[model samples]
Target: MRILLWHVHAAWTTAFLQGPHTYLVPVTAERGPYGRGRAQTYDWPASCVELTPAELAGADVDLVVLQRPEEWALAARWLRRIPGRDVPVVYVEHNTPRRDVPDSPHPMADRDDVTLVHVSHFNDLFWNAGGTRTVVIEHGICPPAAEYTGELDRVGVAINEPLRRWRVTGTDLLPRFCEVAGLDVFGIGAGRLRGLLPPGTGLYDDPPQHELHRQLARRRVYLHPMRWTSLGLSLLEAMMIGIPVVALATTEAVEAVPPQSGVLSTRVDTLVEAVRWLIKDPETATEVGSRGQAAVRARYGLDRFLAAWERLFKEVAPCMSTPSTAR
Candidate 1:
């Protein structure tokens, strides 16, 4: 099947493109937000092809997977096909509600023409679907090959635009964590935190996914400080890399991190203490990390993620089928 999707979330898209299907990604000469084309830092299969707006005008795509709200209009303009009407469409809700807590109505609410897919149960419950068809497809990823060494006594965190999304991404909480252990931050706008962060904390600005995993595994424990998000792929990647996790017990972090696997709490002091203990006792950290790794593999494996997507695609376009694995 030919799938039309934008390169919105890199880690998620990377895993999504691994299946046996041709992925048509929109590309603009500017390579801006809408048309970033394929990922340059991370590796992707040849099956993921890039098409300019002019090229997409003539392409016959089997399904349209919408990420952002604006993509609905872009698809109609570029492909000359109205989503949900001209082509089967599935809108992926990748974020937690930013407006009202539990009262926030989803943008696609009450829409029978499109199906809304949530990445976490927390989002599914919080976002009032209001009669909109919805399903939760929780996050999954292809685990990196790196193993946790925990040689460094520092904490590792991965979040994009931490400066802009300060409180939301828990950038305000970083200083408190830094009081316990130095933090090595990785993501876009991470470098902006330099000089602003406490001394000894390191900043890496959007490194490649493989490099990020490799760096994260070296830290004694992975810190997920995000106050609200669907489920950070980086947190899952850290667990998959066998790193002990210390996360705030908010959003999906509670479900993602089992008690034996890591420490989760709403109190910052409790999380700080947990990180301090994990850094001091390397043996305990290793054991906890191993448990988290096993749990993540069982629940969020790449094969499971892709298979669920395949099922959804089949349901959306029954006539379409996975092509040969030639790519």
Candidate 2:
């Protein structure tokens, strides 16, 4: 099947592209938000073909995958087709409620043509999708090689715009984690994390996805202190790479990380203690990290994600022969 989607969320889009469908991403010279095309920082496959908005106007898209609400209008204008009615549609709910908690109205609320897919169950519960058909397809990742060498006595964190997001990304909590061990932060605008860090904190800007994983796996522990937001792919990737995690007991983090995987709690002291322990006891950390690796491989595997997506596509769109890679 040929699917049309804007490259709104890189990590999620990267994982979604692992499925067996040809994905069409909009490309622009400026490489703006809705037109990020193929990821340069993260490796993506050839199936994720980047075409210009002009070219996409005539593309034979089987299904349309909508992430941002604005994409609905863009899709109609670019593809010359109404997303849900003319083309089968799936609106992926990436983030939890930001405004009214239980009362915030979803952009796709009460829509019958589009199926609303939530990344986590927590998002599904909190979001009021009105009468739109919704489904919870938990995040999945293609596990990187399990290289859990906790030689570096540091806690690694992955966040984007930490300085801008501040407490929301749990930037305030970094001081607490820094008390136990040296800290290394990686992600977009991470270099801007200057002055926000404690004495031992190190700010490293986002590297290529693979390099980031390699550096993060070397750390003794991974810290996920996000107070609000959807589940971070960083945490999942850390677990997939067999890094013991210390995350706040918020949102899906509580359920995603098993007890053996790592420590999940709201108590700052408790998580700080867990980070301290994981850094000191390399053997125990390795054991717990291995448990997390296994759990992620089983629960958040690529095959399962692809299957769920394929099922949804089959339900709404007819099976057409795969498109040729040639332009």
Q: Best TM-score goes to which candidate?
A: 1
Residue 316 accuracy (lDDT) in model 2? 72
For each candidate in the order shown, give its overall lDDT on alpha carbons: 0.91, 0.87
Candidate 2, poorest ten consecutive residues by summed lDDT? 318-327
Please list the residue runs of candidate 2 whose C-alpha ends up more than 4 Å from where it truly belongs after superposition: 319-327
For residues 106-169, write the lDDT of model 1, one tens digit per residue.
9899998899999999999999989988988877788797899999999999999999999999
RMSD to truth, every model: 1.3, 2.4
Q: State the weakest 10-residue window (summed lDDT) of model 1.
A: 318-327
Clashing residue pairs found in predicted model 2 = none
User: Where is model 1 more than 4 Å wrong at Cα?
Assistant: 322-327
